[model samples]
Target: MKKIWQLGFLLTMAFVLLVGCNQSETQKLSTGKSEKTTQTTDKTATYPMTVKDALGNEVEFKEEPKKIVSLIPSNTEILFALGLDDKIVGVSDNDDYPKAATKKEKVGDMEFNVEKVLSLKPDVVFAHESSAKMVESGLQQLKDAGITVFVVKNAASFEETYDTIKQLGQITNQPQKADQIVAGMKVKVKEVQDKVANVKQRTAFVETSGEPEIYTAGKGTFMQEIFDLANIKNVVDDQSGWFKIDPEQIVKRNPDTIIVMEDEKYFPNIVEKVKQRQGFDSITAVKNNAVVKVDQNLTARTGPRLAEGLEEVAKAVYPEAFK
Candidate 1:
């Protein structure tokens, strides 16, 4: 009887140990699943979110936007970068990047088509602060039609541009993608800055247009910020904003470099054109053939490519440093 009781006790103890092992394994799997769920939740934006737009108007989002319309090229570029191309049912006429945007429905250029946008039946419309006043009545028309319109800020600097991207990401349920885009931009910007950190600072003139009236970027403009990042001094830094400057003033400044932001498609041989300008022949940039033509879209559009623009400007200004 003693031997039988001892054996029974041993059997009971073994059964209890086996049950405990099974429970331990089950708990581990449960914990892993819980962790994965939390991670996913953290990456997604919650709906019924009300956020203030650049115009200070409170825009409420009830659910993830399935259909989107971008009224500006910069906004369209941001949307495409966030992998929301499928959701973009309409884009402004000016949106020509990503090659895919051109295939989307065309809204009017500076003057967006309210009827066309309505026809698309977008869940959200991304307008720009720059054209808000110009399209006020039209935007109100869309609002009256019970459509959600969010006026994105005109991003004048890199930081503002990053914020614009993040805001778009939040509304589209692409917060993770936005963060990733911004982080990548920041890294590329830093890399360019570090590359030119030790280079000699050169004076440059950024010409937005050439011929009839010369338009150059000055203080408080996006190109000014690009100049600052690339370690190049803007000869017209004293002037505020973009305006027509006398060609003689450029002669007086005699910048070490002349960076032209004209599209080759519209203005072929733009660099040569700059060199051929009257009295510009004596300029230092023309003498040294330092006139460089950069992609206007890359530098002008405050989008993901702005970092690439910075690198181009930096390399143009200091080619030796990059080499």
Candidate 2:
């Protein structure tokens, strides 16, 4: 009777161990499935997606693009910032940033080469809203060839720029990277704003060109928005858009500082040229030696470096505040 009882006890112990081993294996499989589900949910976009462009045309992507062509420098810069450099097969002739972009196959400047772009067999091509009308025929040709073309909006404000980045991120399946870039931009902008918050506001005049035809950024322009954010007043705020301003008119405005965006390669000694202009010596900026030169690309291009442009402008205008 005692031997039979011991045998029964051993059998029960073996059965309990076997049940515990099966439960452990089942839990492991369940955890792995849950992890895969989370990964799928984290993706910003899925395959066979459709998106609307600035021209109100819908373009569909069967899958994430493996090859891309950017027709504008700004779009190329944004793409590079999103870690899509490896995917870029062609770029505009004017794309000079990121160093590597300069080595890409050129598809022409303002007028892109449809044949060249077609030869690349890109999965998608990025166009800009500013040149949409000018390149309407080329874009249509691309569409007729069954190539996907997305017209990015001409971003005029930081918020609009952020939207562009986010849209591209979703389109390229780099939504997380796009969000991180935008967050960093916002932080930099806020830091500059906070730095100048206690500083006294000063009036400024921004010159985009000089000599034969002088031009300045006025109201309804991106530079005006930058000026506002930097806590600096635009002397030409009364005017709208980029318009020619007489040297005499600048004299009359008597701005506290002057910012020039002309490249030295095209306009050498531009700062001194501004100071030596007839009757400019009497201006406050010229007298105080406050004429500053900033990179045209940084100030003009609507890309990832726009916040850097703002910081450069703010620092140039208010050096004391930054110190």
lDDT of each: 0.79, 0.79
lDDT tens per residue, model 2, 1-323:
33232223222322322222111000001121232211211236766666667677766777899999999878999999999989999999878999999999999867789999999999999998777777899999999999999998777577777777877877898989888888899999999999999888999998877777687877767777789999999999997767778999999999999999766766799999999999999899999999999886786667899999999999889988878
lDDT tens digits, residue span 1-323, model 1: 33232223222322322222111000000121232211211366766666677778867777889999999888999999999989999998778899999999998877789999999999999997767887899999999998999998766578767777877877788879988998999999999999999887999998766667677877767777788988999999997767678999999999999998765665689898889988999998899989998887787677999999999999888988889
lDDT value, candidate 1, whole model: 0.79
Number of the top-ranking candidate, with TM-score as the measure: 2
lDDT for model 2:
0.79
State the weakest 10-residue window (summed lDDT) of model 2: 21-30
Runs in model 2 lying further than 4 Å from the true structure:
1-43
Clashing pairs in 2: none
Q: List the pairs of residues colliding in candidate 1.
A: none
Error of 1 at 252 (Å): 1.0
